[model samples]
Target: MPVVFIHGVATRAGEQYQRGVAAREELIRRLLVDRMAASDPRWAGMQVVSPYWGDLAVRHYWAQATLPPVGTLEDMGVGDDGVAAADLEVADLVKEIGNDATGLEALGAETPLRNAWSKNPHRTVEALLAPIVHSDRSVLRPQDLGITEQARPAQALGEIDGRVLAAGSLAASDEAVGAAIRDALSDDAALTVITDAIVARTEQVAPVEASTDSALESLGPGWLDTLRDRVGEVLNRAKSAPARVATLAALDRYRDGLHGHLTLFMGDVFVYLLRRGEAGSPGPIVERVREAIADAPRSRADEPLIVLTHSMGGNIFYDLVTTYEPSLKVDLWVSAGGQVGQFEEMKLFKASTVVDPPAPPMPPKVAALGGRVRTWLNIYDPADILSFLVEPVFTDPDAGVRIKDLKFKSGVSALKAHGAYYSRPTFYELLGREFGSRP
Candidate 1:
């Protein structure tokens, strides 16, 4: 089988882009190609072709002049000169804990699908970390647990320290930690234990409190008390202000990401829309995809063609196959986190000639693809703002076009969901089961 993957927008040409392409190729090799080969050797040599279009992406002439400055921690009213470092440390720790908690929640929720997708403990743990990290939970507190700080910190610290050490060991290789996470996901008892430990560590045995205690124990309460008195309440602000830190930090991050990413996103989309020339004179990006599809290798004289597109790539291909090359063969066209339906609804794409349903006939372009493209699987995430349902957009039953709109939980929030699809093994697993096993 020959697979062509057209990437989404905001993809700039760099080592990161190269890695993404390579990673997708490997994912297909392991999840789809390798599995298909197990059933039939003919698919043993499945070829994956990922074309680059990021180089032609939107560019800002004025650079920073056009974009507003991203606010620093100081600008967010985080200035206690003496404890600036401590405040940053607390903020970072709180963010990490929040992310871990969210990951644990996603794993717990998706246990069945995760287990079905992969048996490897390492892969399982990796799947846990696959979700987007944008959690902003309130700071875990000892009072909430109905325990005094003194009663739990000692024992809890030991247990939590052990878990941390185990996590740290995996940190060096990164693989070890993911395996532990995956193992924890499989067992509820284990997951609960990990969750409690994390909560305890965050609330009872926080580094801020630990350091304060250490100072008091070594230098005597008198000296520390004197120092605290000198610094006044500001000395304790970082410890008591984690909620503020986490909130402000999350806001800042969201603001920065939205501004930066939205620019390139809109830029690339507009660039493609404005520049995509007429049928005979296709744009550079369109030509790149067309050439890639044409050059895609087939194992046999007649192998089924699979074209997988993400984000704007889906829109580009939708126009390409519909108007430019109406007879192009696409056995399986999977549009994950795409806006093909939305663009058509907005009358943006070149092939948007169809009147909405109740008016019998489907759009010429859509009906054309319905006949040629054997399977039009539209995988979308409810959490993703960018992902839209095609079935609702193009609902012409007589057209013989059935676009499967699958609800895949790609990420936890809008910030992460759009980009989270490709990172998920579960996504690949679904693809493998859906079309990889077909004859």
Candidate 2:
């Protein structure tokens, strides 16, 4: 059977190849296997395929920037030391700049890889944009969109830490370091807006001499020239301000767009998915998905197309399948924490004949999906803010699209619930029963 997993944002090209991606797939395999009584063989050989579309967004912005690749901080001689020094620089900046004490406090409380976000996302945004404020207009321009990348604030802070490290002055005030970076990155239009807002608040903007004195001698002459050339390349990007505005808007669409930068679960997936066009906004990624899953083997007659989707992934598939409509028949659709429930109400999907009270569930003997699918199950955590009852919108007894909604109550908090359904045992058990692999 074709077991396709549609992933949400963040799983960018490089990111999808990381350890966490492998771990999730491994766990899914284990979950499928564990559902059987150690005797079933049907699901034993099943493989899960997750198509990563995160690179689309990165590709979209990079196409416009047209600058050469940015070598790592390690190559620049800044190295991994920036991670440790970044904390120190942040403390200094917070104390000196008087940016956002609440956001800083939240950052301190947050876990690693998840620290830069605040309880108030908008306020945190302000703090991140505070340092670059200058005159009526901030020194940071829309062109700086490229600098936000995967981790905007944290990455921006680390970039400043690199300058501090190269300066050979661990003792330099956070204010001085921020100012130095602002000046050095001035021509580099790809600079992050959050970084500027943060650095601008520092009391003093240090001159290049103040930070680069000793390091400049060891670095030789061409390094500064290369930096200048890169700056020019960044500024010369042909795309106008509208592109930048669209990019920022894209950043705000998925998971309220917070997952792209703040959360570990998502990345730049929305950046490309949100690019609008005459045809459709997600037309690009949707086409890419069609190509990836086009070759699933049809070796077994009993096997039907099986789709497991979560969060934004479900939305993507819903659009794809809905567009194809009655022509597309998914044998089994396993949706968790998805927005599939709202499609009809949003006018994205038109209801068929307004079947008064939704047709109630039928017996197993009645068959499902017009005898095409064994079941259509949706498992979700009640606390997950993203989850909703699909029965109201998806149930169509006439079309044989039966939606069975089940709640998984294991979540400790609303925020934590969105990602927990994947590992929920009840979810796996339901899958096993529906597949008839277990008693």
Q: Candidate 1's error at 273, in angstroms?
A: 0.7
**Using alpha carbons, what is the TM-score of model 2?**
0.45
Alpha-carbon RMSD to native, per candidate = 16.0, 18.4
lDDT of 2 by residue, 20-62 (tens): 3333443354445434425644444455567877666444344
For model 1, how does the per-residue alpha-carbon lDDT over 136-165 read when each residue is reduced to its tens digit?
A: 111122232233445433222222222222
Give the range where candidate 1 is weakest over 10 consecutive residues by summed lDDT.
131-140
In terms of lDDT, model 2 sits at 0.42
Model 1: residues with Cα > 4 Å off, grouped in runs: 40-42, 74-124, 127-248, 354-366, 395-402, 435-439
Per lDDT, the best of the predicted structures is 1
| Clash pairs, model 1 backbone | 125-182
Candidate 2 wrongly placed segments (more than 4 Å): 15-17, 33-44, 58-282, 298-301, 349-374, 398-401, 423-426, 433-439
lDDT scores in order: 0.55, 0.42
User: What shift in Å separates residue 323 of candidate 1 from its native position after superposition?
Assistant: 1.0
